[model samples]
Structure formats: C-alpha cells, structure tokens
Target: MAEYIMAEKNNRMIPEEDKIFALNARAKKMSEEVGRDKVINATIGSLLDDDGKLVMLLSVVKALKGLEPLDFAEYAPIGGTTDFKKAVKKAAFGKHRSSSFVEVVATPGGTGALRNIVANYSKIGDRVLTSDWFWGPYKTITGELYRELCLYPMFDENNRFNKKGFSEELNKLAADQESVLILLNTPSHNPTGYSLDGDDWNGISEAVKEASKKARITLFVDAAYIDFAGDEEEYRTFLPKLEDMPSNVLPVIGYSFSKTFTLYGMRCGAMIAMAPSEEIAAEFKLVNEFSARGTWSNSTRSGQVLVSKVYEDEDLLESVNKERAGYREMLIKRGKAFSNSVIEAGLPLVPFDSGFFSCIPLKDPAAVSKRLEEKGIFVVPLAKGIRVSVASISEEICRKLPGMIAEVIE
Candidate 1:
C-alpha cells in the first residue's frame, strides 16, 4: 500500500462507480453465455440497433472522415472556432433566436458544460435545483463541486409537469441561497423520458423570473437529447423566451453533439450564455474560456470543424436532419409501444413523452431489477424505479420488455 496525499476535498471522497456500466458488463457476459438475441440489455442510454450494435449517422461519419489531417492534429481554441460557435448557437436557438447577447464556449461534452455551470454559477454549499427523477450524473457533478442537489417532484398526480411543486421548491431554495442555479434537462429527460411542452416551459420561465427578484438566478438548459426528442424546430419553440430576461437572470444552454451528430467519443459540445446586456455576455464568455483553460485546455478540433462543416452545407444539413428523423421516429414508436404494453400489462410507470429511457415505478427497484435480470432482462434500478432504455432496444423488444418486468414485479 502507498501513502495517500490528498486535498481536503479529496479526503472525503469514496470510490463512486456508475452502476449502469456494471449492469451492462453483466448483461454482455450473459449475452455471450446465451445468444445475444436471448438477452434484453436495456442498461445504456446510447442508441443501439436491433442487433445490439452502436448506431452512427452516415452524414456525421462522412463529415468526420472527410476532415483534413491537420484538423485532427491541431488544438481548438478554448472557446472553439468562430464558425463552430455560430453553428451551435444556431442549432440551440433554431429560427426563433434569442435577441439577448449570447456567447458560446466549447466544452468536451455536455458533461463538461454541466461541470462548469455547477462550479461557477453557484457558491459552495448552495443547493442546485432540478427534478427528482433526473440523470444520476447531475448529483455527481454537484457533489464534486461541494454543492447539494435539491429536487422537486417531477410530475403531478395527473402526470403533467408539476409546475406548482416546482414553483414551491424554487421559492424555498431562493430563501436559502443568495444565488440559485436551476438546471432543467428536458425534451426527453433521462431515466423517465418525461418531456415538458410549451406550457411547461412558460411556467418554468415565469418561475425563474419571479425567483430572480429574490435571488440571483442562473438557468442551465441541458439539451443533450433535444435532437432525438421530436421535431427539431418544435422542441426549440421555448428558447426565444429567454430573450430579454431580467438582468439578474442568466439563461445558459448546454448543447451536445454526442447524440445529434453520433460523435460520442469525439467529445464536442458548447455552453451558450444569454444575457440581457452585452457586458454580461462578454463576462460570461471570458469566465467560460478561463474555466476551459484551467480544466481540459481545449475541446477536440476535428469534432468542432466537422460539426461546422456539416451545418454550413445546406445539402449536408438537410441529409443529416432527414436521417435523424428516421431514428427519432423509431424512438417515438418504441416509446409508445413500451408505454402501451405497460398499460396493457397493468404495470405503473412514470409519465413519458419522447425520450431515450422510461421508468417503471416499483416499491423495491433493485429487488425487481435483479429478478428481471435472472430472466435475461437487464435494466438500471433508480431510486424510484427501474429505468428501461427504449433507445437501445428494438420496438419488438420494447413491447415485450414491460411484460417481462411485470412478471417479475407482480
């Protein structure tokens, strides 16, 4: 054994491993023991074909392959190239672009953007607000920065966005903290696949604006799954609402190419900040770049260049969106099939609307998940339920999965 030297922050750290990967590894081994078709592996959120292979977009791959060697060998600027930054902002805003001053900074992935936001936006020990059913990594990110995560019940009894609950929590958090950062991952939320519609966004905006009067507010929108959620333009309809926000309220978007461009390994994404005034936007850019320099130094150059090239070409952009539409439709179909099957099987689930994963509520999620695993079905067990990855399996499997889970739970 070697002596361990650590900072005060590092001293309290215990080994924290993601259970999803462990479950996936076990699923992979079982798949080998019994043929691949015999096992239901719904452990990961990544898009996978019926044959359990990774799905990549042809247009995205072509753009990457066509890149010059220099692109791969060089380092991107801390804030990314101008063209790439503009492309990301355009993608985030759609045609209804925000009139506020906006600044974009390249990060390794959406994860990096989340990390920066948690580290910089809130003071140490402040609670970052989100829904109860959220991506597990949000807690990990906040905890690492010495910030606590506070969650409101995600839905009401009627299975709609719990605007009332959210408002209550927002006010409570505002009372406790001088600065509040609200992170909403929507249009296909992780673990539950729950999405907020236009009305939901309006309520959220109103709540944030109201809270800003009592406490400085920073709203972070994590749109990593936006492309796969539904019609691109329709999902972005609420983005323009951020324009002309109160000076104390800052709206920042964390955009990722991992799912949109099928470039997960390339690790390219952007953090976009919108402010009522140009001075605030400039300050946002400067601090973001400074953070980038201190952390990863720069994002991948070729990844940034490829995204810029694809969006810049009208034909290529059209082709990419068309191809994505096919997959998005498939995901929607799979989601519907699973939800229908769950309803028919008399199994209860959290509300779902266009997303990669769904949650089936259970009293003992881990016990239920293990029982399902014994029958060759693997899923992630969350605090409130078992998370099924509709994005990873076939529609047929999705239809069959709920029945399998119901048998074990019931």
Candidate 2:
C-alpha cells in the first residue's frame, strides 16, 4: 500500500520552502555565525536603514500605539470598516481619484487582493496575463487557484515597455477565453523597478479597450510599491487613465498598506474596483466580500484602525507623508548610486526608473546567485535574472555590488 497522505492531492506537490524566505534564512544564519557587516543579504524586500535596521514610520507607530483596546481588539466587519474603505481609496488614488463608480474590499495584503481577483475573474485552467518580469507570488496565486499564468516580454529592442507584445498577448488571450485578467504592476514594479509612464498607460488602455471587444477584460493594477516609486503625486498620474474605459473593461487596483504605511506584518490592504456603473461596482463588492469570508474571514482590525486614524486627521496625515517622503529620498539616492555603478562597471541591468528593487538579466541566474552567496552576498535568482533589493542595502553596498557582480560574470 502507498504511504498515507495528508494534504489534498492537488496541494501535495507544493514546494515546502519559499525561495526568497529560504535564502533569507540562510543569510540570517550566516550573519549569526559571522557578523552582519560581513554579509550582504538583499534577498528580502523590506526597507532598511543604513545600519540594517527595519525602518518604520514614527507617525504610523504613534497612531498604532494610541489605538484603544476596543479599536484593535474588536472584530472589523467582513469587508472592512467603513472608514477603512474610504481611507484606502484616498490612500490609493490621492488627487487622481477615478470618475467611475468605485467599490472597495479589505484584503490581508496585495497578495490577498491578487488571489481574490484570480479566484473570481478567471475560471479554473484559464490563463492570467502579466509582464515577463513580475512579482513571483503572481504565479503562486494563479497556480493555487488552478489557473495558468502567462507573460508578455516586458521590454522591446529599444528597451521600453513592449506595447506591441502586450497587445498581442491581450488579443490572443481575449480571443480564446471568455474573460482575461491582466495584472499590471506599475509605479515601481518588483525585481526590475520599471514604472509605466503616461504613454505606456495609454498603450495599455488602448490595448485593453480594443481587446474588450473580444472578451471581458479585468485590468488589475498592483500598486504595491507606489509610495516608494517617486514623488507620490507624480507617480499617480496614470490612475486617471484607468477610468472611463469601455464598460466591458473593468479596472481593479490592489492597494497595500504594507509598504505605504510600513505595516508589513499587519497584513492589510484593499482591492478597489472602478466600474462604469453602480450595478457593476455593487456586484464587485458583493462577490469579493463573499470570497473574503470564505478565505480569510476578516482582515486585522488594528491595521484598519491605523489607516483610519491617520487619514481622518489632516495634521497626522501630513506628518506621515513627510516622514515617508524622507525615506523615499533615501531610496532614490540608493537607486541612483546603483544605477551609476552599473553604468561604470558596464553591467547589463534591466531598465529601472525608481523602485525598491532592480534586476540584472543574465543566463543561469541561480548559479550566479549561488556564486555570490559564497562571497557572503545574497540576492534573489529569478528565471531570467538576479534581483537586488536596493531598499535593504546601504549605498556603499549598492555602489560595490555592480563591480562584484561584473567580476563574477567575467
């Protein structure tokens, strides 16, 4: 007889260890053995100060500490507290709020929002589309939902957003499926740090608008790193473009407080829908709320209260933004340092604007990452490249890494 199995058959093959977490664990163990100064662990995607301490916004911390027991201990409504929904919309849209009917549902994080989208928008065995360089969890989310993840090349020969490839894939998928869910992570895309400009957004809008003629289109914008991308208001200009699309083309924005509010462990975010009509927006809220109840019963109340408290008070909001802007400047400085070093070393890097991460495309990324590990340096190895977390490292490390990676490649 075969050995008894515990998990459902479909779940049995899931990898026990997450690649990033496993690498991070190894890096930490090494740090314990030697010292932190000797190690360069860029495996995690969290903001860290120069001394390698996790950076938390003082304003956010104060607000959290001030919350009364009832505010945090009591259960929030299934969808989210009313104030949270309002605050999340404000946080996500800023001054570029959409003109369409809108709805919001609280999710554990951007991960949960993506999961809900895949669960509701696409049928099992259907394909979900995104750029070639995307957050790895996208594949995980789609796979767990029994859906396929497809990709279009992110850049063309000119080293720009590949609008043609995106259109081709969108048209192809729309033709085959009843509905297509396209995930676009912009204003600081992971691993590559590429943000879509107005023109790129226009191209996407046109492509989806055209593709919607063939099938229903759900345009999911994952703005997980938006706050850290650049000037907050400037990075949000593309948001208005997400509005006024054909009724068949639905725009969904995944907003995460993890990065925006430095509440990573709080597991809080929201899925926002911009529908052409009130009926569609209501339908979105109902369906996503049902999904939320079935999966994670409710998001953390404390996190919701933190957002509400901050947003409701203008003085506190300004303080939080000011603190966050300072960190954003630090990230920009680090990104510039790395980009300059890469150019000086003649290292081939994927096009990066402003974001927490950047990628160096190459063959055998895993092997190269392993070699770097031996040198007390750790970075994530993707299918096509090695990802370096600029947010987690010091400027000195940022400046030195390109040369070290170049030497390793040679």
RMSD for each model, in Å, please? 2.0, 1.7
Candidate 1's TM-score reads 0.96
TM, every model: 0.96, 0.98
**Model 2 reaches what TM-score against the true structure?**
0.98
Model 1: per-residue Cα lDDT over 164-185, one tens digit each? 9999999889988899999999
List model 2 lDDT by residue over 75-193, tens digit each.
99989999999999899999985789989999999888999999999999899999999898888788888888889999999999999999999999999999999999988899899
Candidate 1, residue 135: how far the Cα is off, in Å: 0.6
The C-alpha stretches of model 2 lying farther than 4 A from their native spots are 1-4, 11-13
Error of 1 at 250 (Å): 0.7
- Scored by lDDT, the top model is 2
Clashes of each: 0, 0
Evaluate residue 198 in candidate 1 and report its C-alpha lDDT on the 0 to 100 scale. Answer: 79
Q: Which stretches of candidate 1 lie over 4 Å from their true place?
A: 1-16
